[model samples]
Target chain A: MIALVQQDGPLRIEITEGVIEPLPFAIPTFQDESGTAGAIADEISRVIAADLSGTGLFREIPSTSFISSVTNFSAPVAYPDWKAVNAQALITGAVTESGGQITVKFRVYDVFSGAELGQGIQIVGTTAGIRRIAHKVADTVYSRITGETGYFDSRVVFVSETGPKNARSKRLAVMDYDGANVTYLTDSQSLVLAPRFSGSGDRLLYTSYETGQPQIYVMDVGTAERRALGTGGGNMAFSPRFTPDGQGLIFSLEQGGNSDIYRMDLQGGGLQQLTNSPAIETAPSFSPDGTQIVFESDRSGSQQLYIMGAGGGEPQRISFGPGRYGTPVWSPRGDLIAFTKQNEGRFHIGVMRTDGSEERLLTASFLDEGPTWAPNGRVIMFTRESQGSDGAAGLYSVDISGRNLRRVPTPDSASDPSWGPLQN
Target chain B: MKKITIAVMLVSALALTACSKNRFNGQDGTAGAGTIQPGSANDPSSPAYFNQTIGDRVLFAVDQSTLSAEAQSVLTQQATWLSNNPAYSAIVEGHADEQGTREYNVALGARRASAVQSFLIERGVAPNRLKTVSYGKERPLAVCSEESCYAQNRRAVTVLTSAAGS
Candidate 1:
């Protein structure tokens, strides 16, 4: 039955099932004789190779398999030697330490084309920044080839869950975009949900039931202090998100009995209602330009996504495919909106153009929702919860092309992820 | 049958009173009291008796916001009991079945609580006497992954506080 159902889903299945050529590349360890600088350099190369190889976009040639030493940064042409090992691309770099600071320089060459694709130099405060430097180099190479920004330097904020399912304790946690350096941002005993980063990655807006009511609160990511926004008495307010400009917030406010979308100034007072309909309107996200917004509402009787002007204009329905859609987050590029769709008893994380055309569901499982774009918009991170016994939720990231599915390490079960922009 | 009729009459009266916005103005000013325990006022064998005890929480299907008929019946009985005890102002805690996104589930939980709140109001309970909060899927009543457990986790719970007591 599942096979029969899969046969009818979409046209991409046929294209995805076909054989395709994998990009072959070679990464040589940095030549730095002795000590921590050399060790860090080698690890950086390894991580960069792993990041690229894991994307399924590149096939890395083992260092042991290489026919050439690539040790000298100023070495002459060795295209023939690289080609002998079936390498299409070659990356070589070196590391140096001076004045208690480290500098790493790397270069990418298209062995097949016999031309340098890109080169980069990074200076780090400590050995730990070597990995970040490596990531930046990888981003540079990736963007040069794909014509899209890389997402490796960003971070994600999500709800970390522990304890029994019925009485789970949840805290807001943040981690590097590649799922390293996990840190807890809030220690509230009450539940925290739907965290979103300001464009600067310094402040976050999320909903907390700490006061016995669901209210929107903004917290400094570094200080952990928070202040409530708006005055809606005790009515429910949730799904808080910041405007791209960081000057305002868009969220859902439940008043009287109806839930509607509203936007308020981040610094203070007055509230402006965006959607005055009787339908449940929540999960509002702003476009990169801040002139438009995308959110999920049940105005059509079932939860679907809609896009509208930032100032509350006519909204155009963007989701028409099977199942219900919710949690629509606009990409920082302003070109796509990532959302969660529930269809045929299964959930999926998908992205569609701003107008909702060409919808592509990236990951499908018992449950997958709350997709937040990596700062550069090349990847999406979302929570995937398994079903039945042993059921648990964890963070997962996939390229926008629907490749490189990998689990992000978290201290506990995580959900409702929101990715912050690249650190300055 | 006699007991069922009496319970239905009480529910109808409460539902009627809920529709009027100012219905709480004439009641014992202590309508906000929150100390009424569930299942304490009826025969122990009666379904309504569960209202006086810590009532069981209802579970929901994945990504669903609508209450099942059984859950609605539970809420109806809860509303009827709240009407009978005027001193008990209750908070409806909405919860999800653990199958959707946290934010959406929070919203879904709210919709569930709102659905129950509107139902109770339509059945004549005062709006001020009832408040709603959504826990999304954060607070579950059951921990298992089976349908039996999931059903119990998706629920709108009536938490009676001391504020309603006169």
Candidate 2:
């Protein structure tokens, strides 16, 4: 927890500098110009503030600390009053409703410079999606101030877990990036794991233990409709991911006793085996550009990561550290691959360059696995299960710079988060 | 007392004769020989017998699929039991301890299950009567984080089904 009005310096924060002091910012409740939208306008303003403050990059200045309040939508700038309260950034907005739709307009201001950082913009949406409208507002402000895309408007598909560790039941679920609007996709009668999002963010691919077999299934997110992906026919298959184009899938298929990587054309129904190995090979992920794939294999007698072309061929080993690596997820930016590493009984969430250099472990825990990259490629979310008879699993996220580690709030014990792209 | 004991032995012999005829189609084989109740742990042909006497599961070491001598011993008995019960098909469920990543544990469990499958095939069990699935670290028999529990969690269980066998 950080104080609302704190300061480090006026210098521009370089993201690569690692953990820095939180910048102080203030967002006054959007003025309800129509008076009819007062409640919703305040709600929208609160959501935007929560979205920005949750990043740990900015701290909120409580309304009680404000020296002056602007009750007008087009009020002249009172930058001196904002700077007097130690505010480095300020956001002011107004909301109005006509019939069923509401319009929200906001401006981002650099209090130190006494100028609006970006031109004021207005967003129009229905009252039913007020929170989404707020998230979009925060995203615009974040992009203008940080010079990076925002992840606030995205949704995460994950495995919602229930019951005890030994007798647990898992259901496929989707929720807002901030853990709101939870809607389950499957019942708890069967076990599910590792739900991945399509590039468009409207479809999902996951593994389910239906038919007394572990098989992959692709689902239409809006309809909750699904069908088994018949890549392996009568064999066991799991750990599926969609290609960048969403026209193909890469997954693991087990035959006889060996598990290997496989690809399937979603539209043409053509299947291709990507790896042929007697040793264990599974958990394959495609590069952002879809030309390369990173996967884990024990072909060298232990679990290590290897890179191969999207089309099958010989794989070049990439992971050379002392620890074992698995669940390698390519960053949305296509530059880094995040993975789960285990060494000497401890687990870590780590990231490495595509060529396996600059290997940095972002988090260490009793159990941390299944890293999912945020749309901006600046943060990674994963599952962290505690160690004990009563230990439980939960979702957590960390900045790519390895700071601001926080548990993502969820309705129940959850794991295996796959973040979708920013909503349109 | 001696006369009654002789009479009882004759009746038991009659019951064993009925069992040798495969009267129950040899599917579950829960019916016992002679005085033992059907499906009881003491029943020689019952799945309970296979579970308790022939061993329904084989344990694996951390991150290893190489069968230990003890595991092979249990699997050998399982093979003989399956061979005798021709009406049963087996689904070998391979599992791993909660110490590894989800998908890697899955691949490791597959290796363990395949090891057992190979051993069973070597022992003359029909390959068609066998199928394998790796649960990875999704399911666990023991919930603790210690080696004692992990040893039990890392196992491959041969679950018998009543489906017709070729």
Candidate 3:
């Protein structure tokens, strides 16, 4: 039965399972409304186009292909000109600079229907945060066009590596989702690994080896002040992750020569042992709702994935595959879990349901591990080390559908990336 | 025949010099691995001597930590030396081959070190004299990807330190 599709508005494009043709969109360089706007207008427009094109769902028509240009920000778009060029969607924006602050406003139109999708909104921020303002605008347009949350406005906390493999140095680094505006949080005096951001992205949790042994530490990303998590009690702790609400942390602690998972209340200083087995248990990630946790354990004599209650109880094994699985991260959308699997001399990044069914491998290489999700759950970034003795580690991201695989730019080798939530 | 005799005499003279020089100074052209100093009984450097000559590390099979007969023999020698020199304490650093995940390798390394520690204790070494730490695959003695290098990396090393009165 063919159902008549109703167009909710000009921006609503119905997506179905079939051969999908790329949508053509156009964004003329944004106009400068004030003399002080300088080159920000053009830079912001280019960034927005790049962001949209990176998704692989839309193709940006070069400005040379446009029949007309948007010289004024407030003027209505000439729909006939865009329709003539076969451009289905068009975005127009203006930039103004005043005092030490900059403001940007943009509008999106469905040229085919000749209707405005939404009213133009203005974003104001400090001149230093112009890129952030641009990202915010692009996120707005992306959400409106695709009807999905945008991940471009998020950040990633990862381990920046340098030097040789035997004596490598690692520091915690943060950057924009597109690998821009990088800032190092640690001085590399100690080895850092597996940095995870809080729900609000105000703080970070990672494992550091400052005291001659791996220990968990939490730091305020803005202030750079840090403190050891929980009382060390003469034990080693590592593989840390924040709880869903950011009020607690789940990590692996080695005591008496055995490793197990534990949960700690950050606000109340309460500690609870989640798993009490002689076998190894580590890499615990909370479900989006904070009711369940999916982690890796070796109780069955080989590494495998398992799920248990947040408060801790009997854990039912989720992975029964042929190879070992580790570093399981639940998707923000609460539909799938991403993990690193080692099988037949090769490592791969894979995803599976909460019940461990319909497993799909996204990437395969000599060594690919530590998969983290984008804010929108559409992409995953992981550590891929080359083969042989001279191999180096670097960060790579792939769309969840296994397309658009790209290397994230970094000055040195990088690993253990944890993408943060979208900035408010 | 005269030239051959002279050549053998020159070679014998050079070998004699090398042997006398090594016997007096304990120095050789080759360095690293098995560079030991000849000493008397109950030498003040006995702990270092044991570490350098008797071997302080034992290798393990791929992912298994079960002690091999050769590894057990080394541990037996270590136990005897530790009992003879009670003032020295040992730290067993467990390490794993870079063939598995980081977290699992760490656990596997810890198990290997614990195996060494248990064997030492069972052989009459004081439990308090031994401490265990798992470096996982972080610290590798050999930096290669082949099995020969991996065999060297998957080992537990016993590092001895002087505890003075203890």
Candidate 4:
């Protein structure tokens, strides 16, 4: 909870319970400044409401319960009417469309203090980008109220699956963080797995068996143009991730029946071998600072999480739990690493400190793997395959606290989710 | 299971003798009648015959890549088949029961395939004739969720292809 002092009045305080009790907010349908705005204004308002409500931090006051509605964009705030309904925050917006360009202007108000939290701003984009405008508005409102950067503006890249358990077809698909506006980046001609976004979100790194073997590929997200990373032939590659700077790739390559981690410079096209051992070493992820790499290995006899210097040196084992741990992803905040644990015939999604202490399992199921962090590091999303022969894979998201576990709706079976950073 | 294996062996032996009888089958007309007996494990045209009759796969225990006595028996047979079939190379595709993380399962699958490869090499199969690929849990042999199906799914299958160098 955060306490905000009224900027318009003298020392009047208001408490915003962002987590305990969701702050009550109302978003009246945006006014269409031009008749050509069509239904985009209402659609944008709905997306904004959905984004805020999905966070579990805001309770939307239905339009029917509203005591008052603002029909004009420049109208004054009726604080008493909103306060009567126990609404703590109010959002107002207007949309205009001209020459195929759409502009959305919005303002957030503290209903109790009757103060505009900040100056209203207008964002313009193509009409096709109206959803992004809505997300921008929600991001602004969320940031202003909670004092935290909003993740609504981010995107997710995941594996879209179809067909049966024996012969499933998978392709790379990208969508908004809320699972809207999905666009397929690859066809199902070849099997694809674990699509990860570069820090800039302009490119994707994933494993593909298009050439009759598993190999890593980097694709431009916009153009869908892709090229495979050179593995010098007679070697198999998978489990690829980008460095924080997005200038390098760290991945696992198997040659002569031995799997080890390696790093490749995206520009220089040179490979740096990271780990050398007879045991299997895969699933390498870099620390937030790129100073160290955490990966899974069977070098210690069972699959365990380990950390080593980025330049590849003596590795220290981190996880000492009973189960085998793999798919370790360092959180953006650098304090925690999320992984999938298999124990006693059950799979779990869990988090632990960098030192391997305070290990907490957030989810347990028949299968849950491939954990990816939200841009804000407050949430984690992973693939959860249902139990049974008819069971299908689905994408699920959970807050770091393990509350608010929700399935992200997808058109078909989804897996290998990798949430991209917030778009610029 | 023992009866089924014996029945399959008897049927294959009968088919091998029938196919050995000289007849010009258009499928392999380029070769002489007895050059390619495209039946049973001895037939070059029927990889399925080798897969089913000669046993192209070895199953493993859950989460254990170390070959059991039964898996070793199967691999011994596979090694013998590979030794006799010198024109073919085998790609060992390792698969797991759908029970673990994708990345770890891939590594586990690799270990399983490598185990099979190493065992075959020790059994006199040429190392250069063997390659390994792990499909992880992505491809399952059986769709059922029970142990009966998972046992079949946790396997390393030796798929034979014509040796590129040969």
Candidate 5:
């Protein structure tokens, strides 16, 4: 329950309580000499409005309801006109084009308090960059008001699927986390299962069936060039994951009909077998310190989770609950392990402490698994498949508290989401 | 409870048919037929006591690396069969539901196969004769959008590459 009251000098402010209503804001159209430029300004404002309003965190006042027009972009905003419409905040901008470059200048005002919040200017390569420029402006305003970092600039990498159920085609696609700027990194002809970002978000490691067998491949995000890491033989190799340091890869290799967990140096040519058992052991994720690995195994006649030292000692079973657990990924924070749990025909995405205690089921549905941590470790993004006439798989994000479940937008069906480390 | 009963019945039917198929296949010299004596456990008439096919797999719930009681029973039967035919070596391939992250699913698959291996060892089957690997949702016998298909995909399969009586 925070409220802002304006004062003079550097837009001084004070907070109050009692009314926690949304801070009213007005975004007037940016003045432009050309109609196209005006249209671009209008669209940018619309995107900003959409982004802010969708969060359920802001209230936008309509210009039609305004008492006065913002005709002069450079002139001081008539605070009374904005206050008359009950808009606590006012945003004004102008678009200017020179030598094939577009520049947008914008300012924020606290209308009721009659003070300016901030002002910014952005130059873009083309009019297309206008939207992103607007996004940056909106992010600045929102952060100033809410006191939190904005996610508008981040991107998401997921597996985009098509074709029928039996022979689905998958490719790696990356876009703004909000589903804009969709770009496919790999051609859809190959079957790409999971695409996980390296620590730097500049590269990706994923499983591809391009060679008719599941093999791990690493691709540069910028160049889209891929190189096979391990020399995959007749045996299938799948589920390649990067060590926290990004210097080694942990993956499952099927040799002589047996699948075992192996770690290989990303640069050097040494493969180390991490687990040697008759039971299937795969999906190894390193602890933050790279000292222990948490993975799923069926060593106890059921598929349960186990943790062991990175050097391949005996594993201690961590899951003792009512159902089977799989896909244990260590959180980047090193406090919990996220996994998928199946019980009584329902699949769940859950997290438990590193020792397998304090298991909390974050989501439950017909089919939900694959929990990847947000770069900040506050939220998890996973794929949820609904069962019905329109049974489809899509990417979904949920707070670790099991609240704020929201669908991440994608052009087609998406799954196996891997949240990259925060962008630089 | 009703669903569980039906599932039990279905499992029984599948086990009976699987056992008959194993006998027929063994007689055909896919592998020499070795008598699979039911170990001391539950009722002999129960499907759990029947000798299961050596090279078969059991489905798991999505993301579940834990073996169900049904899966444990199947592995027990497999262990008895393996011990009786000591020359045979097996590879357990673990898999996961397609709904998961693939790397984690591979680990989950490995857990599933390892669960079977430990169960076989507890039942007197030598651990050295068995090997485990995880497919992690890479291979699918049934490809559909339905839960049934996903359940079948999440599994650990014991593949007998060598004949038991060789």
Candidate 6:
């Protein structure tokens, strides 16, 4: 039955099965129903094309090569003209601005079948948040064709770094998934790292040196108001990830030079020690179901991944490879754990099954660590730093298939990205 | 009778807070902060003397927190100097080279700092005069990416301050 559908199908790329080659698509310049939004319409069209093309699953056919122009969004698509240009998908849109609000309506068409894949959508957002509007439109288009959730309508919290390596200053920052509208949450007076968002994307958990030691700090993403978490600030705590329930946090707490994974109640002020070995145990994350946790430990004499019951039990070692693994974040899909591996003086971003099989390294760099999952669980964003005195860190994303590696644009050097859940 | 019990409870809580303050020099205001003479590097009992004559920092091997003979020797002197100067407290800053990831390097630096804290305690320096903070590879003393710079960057520096409570 599947083969029958594909044989006479409207062009579709199986993102999970893997696209052998990028599917060719064309998106004409969006029409501006309101003459005042002509430039905005063109920009929205360009952004949508770029978003699809950036996935590496779609190759956008340039407007210069288009045989038929989409001067009217409601007009019937010319199938033969699109076929002549070898375009598999066609998208047309229109943008209108009234008062202080802007509206964008778009439709995705399977050029071969000459039919709209889904009902048209008109997204409404403020003029100040025009980029978000474009992302939403692209998300609709992407989901209509790929039959999967879109990651375009998302945000990432990262640490923006500046100054020389020896005296680098860092601030907590958040940006759009493509690195737009960067807003700094904290100034660079004190160093901050590893900002992980809550389940609802309304709050963040990160490590800050505000009290003269690395302590977990919780922040309201909207108001930027933050306070020290009750995880024993003087004892030194870092690497905190919110529990699946978002009512508590799982993090590493250091005492007398030894570190261990722990979970704490965000409201009741109860602390649970999850790991109690003399060896370093840090970077704990819970599976989506919240029954088990995946963490990295050096109890085996070198860093390796381990899985244990969330309530604390004898952990089973899951990473047996030759390299050291740290920062193991359980994928949202619950089947894989993404990690940072260091071996032979080089670093990598890799993923493996929960049972520790079918390991695949997605990126190798001089310094790369801290993997954060996109909402869809198909993409991973991590920090990549260069080598030498002038070394700088930047955020990069790679799909689960290990294709489409692209640097996330930022106004300054950024690292330790925590991709937030899809926005409402 | 209930009022009397409440008064006793408040008194005991005040006493406990006072006892906690004894752990650090001058923590209860400026008890010992004034007498620790602000002498230059020449004064035998001054923090400057301890920093210059006795090394202020000790280096470690890559990813290793175990102290070397050289690092141990320097730390031994530091322990004695800390014992001699009761009014000054030290913050041991543990650091790692840029060869490791951020979170792991932080753990490694903590181990180095803790090692120093243990050695100092063993050599008769009061635990109350010492605190530890790990910067991981965030703050490096040497800027280059070579081994020489990494060797220097992987270190534990004992910074002194008067009336320190942390």
Task: Name the runs in model 2 displaced over 4 angstroms.
Answer: A1-13, B1-35
Off by more than 4 A, model 4: A1-19, B1-38, B41-49, B164-166
Runs of candidate 5 exceeding 4 Å displacement: A1-24, A33-36, A83-89, A110-113, A118-125, A231-235, A253-262, A268-339, A350-361, A388-390, A421-424, B1-166
**Docking class for candidate 6:** acceptable
Worst 10 residues of 4 chain A by lDDT: A10-19
Which candidate would rank higher by DockQ, 2 or 5? 2
DockQ of each: 0.17, 0.22, 0.12, 0.20, 0.10, 0.24
Query: What's the C-alpha lDDT at position A131 in model 1?
Result: 67
lDDT of 1 by residue, A210-292 (tens): 66677888887776667878647788888888888788888888875468888888875668899988777888888888888
Greater DockQ among 1 and 4 belongs to 4
Chain A, model 3: TM = 0.95
lDDT digits (tens) for residues A1-424 of candidate 2: 2222223333233455544678788998999988899999899999999998888788899999999998887988798899899788999999999998999999888887777777999999998889999999999987876778999999999999989988998888889999998888877766788999999998999987765578888888887777777765567888999989998899998888788898987752878889997988888999988899999998897889999999979999999999799999999999999999999899999999999999999999999999999999988999999999998999999988788899999999999999999999
For A178-200, candidate 6 gives per-residue lDDT tens digits of 98878888777677889999988
Off by over 4 Å in 6: A1-7, A17-19, B1-42, B164-166
**Scored by CA lDDT, what does every candidate get?**
0.73, 0.85, 0.81, 0.83, 0.70, 0.84
Per-chain TM-score (chain B), model 4 = 0.72
Considering TM-score, which of the candidate structures 5 and 6 is the better prediction for this target? 6
lDDT of 3 by residue, A30-97 (tens): 88989778588888888889888877667899999899989888787899999899787899988898
Candidate 1 docks with a DockQ of 0.17
Predicted structure 3, TM vs. truth: 0.88
Q: Docking quality tier of candidate 4?
A: incorrect
Worst 10 residues of 5 chain B by lDDT: B1-10
lDDT of 5 by residue, A217-306 (tens): 887777677777764554567767788888888877765445678889877377888889866677778898899998887778767899
In model 3, the runs with Cα more than 4 Å from the true position are: A1-20, B1-48, B164-166
TM-score of chain B of 1: 0.63
TM-score of chain B of 2: 0.77
